[model samples]
Target: MELRQYLHAHGKDSIGIIGVSWAEDRFGDPSESRLQRIAAFIDPKIPVVRETDDLVKAFSPLEQVPANFVYNRSGKLIYGDGSPKLMTKKQLEGLLAGSK
Candidate 1:
């Protein structure tokens, strides 16, 4: 949720959140819950694409655009690990600030 706020604060209308399905086994549902929290915290009207369980198993979104790395208009990686990194609210804020 915080990440969405940070991105909005920086004038971005959309930002992506990526997670591996395996994360559920390691981190539990709180991770997905957190995304929901962030959506509620930021813009309830915004869209969130959650890829998990049958959603991911049936559709491989990551196979097209992995996670973590930020892509510029030209398709260049700007920040983040080339894959998603579990981040805290503060870390997400810092990253959003850097993107600005």
Candidate 2:
């Protein structure tokens, strides 16, 4: 999903973006660059990260799976599921807006 819309829906809230290569093919590296651009353009304060123990971390080789996972500040698992549903930009926005 596009970062700006997601941030707008969250409205000052923070969210992580973890990419699972095997989970979804909708997001590719080239498109990720676009998403990054959107992030920079809109929600620069949200913070985007890759491979960190923070809010977000993109992983590859999903089948080589690890038991570990990252959680949100609320202690919710943000990754490590088998084939997560691909979140479209609008879907993400809706979810974030509705999240408590």
Candidate 3:
């Protein structure tokens, strides 16, 4: 299962997934329609937000595009990587196992 599905099925209301798109430096706000389109490709209904000053402060600095950060329920950063493999089911299981 994907991250969202995995979380929904086994997370037991403990996990929430959100996507942050980092393109403000090059393209700026993608607008509501584009945000919706991005959300369309995302399974399990995850909220996708554009980068902003508040988001930067909340999510930490973005080193590159597709920065992935995993935060605990207390809002503390746990796992972070820039690799797309972060979506792999096995890797996600490993990432979330100890988190629970």
Best by the lDDT measure = 3
Lowest lDDT block of 10, candidate 2? 17-26
Flag clash pairs in model 1.
1-38
Model 2 pairs whose backbones collide: none
Runs in model 3 deviating more than 4 A are 1-14, 28-31, 81-87
Runs in model 1 lying further than 4 Å from the true structure: 1-5, 12-22, 29-34, 52-67, 82-100
Clashes of each: 1, 0, 0
Q: Rate the local accuracy (lDDT) of all candidates.
A: 0.52, 0.47, 0.64
Residue 17, model 3, lDDT: 73
- Model 3 clash pairs are none
**Preferred candidate (lDDT higher): 2 or 3:** 3
- Pitting candidate 1 against candidate 3, the one with the higher lDDT is 3
Tens digits of lDDT, candidate 1, 1-100: 4455566665555465443333344454447676666556656655666445786554333333224455554555566543445455576556555766
Q: Which 10 consecutive positions of candidate 1 have the poorest summed lDDT?
A: 58-67
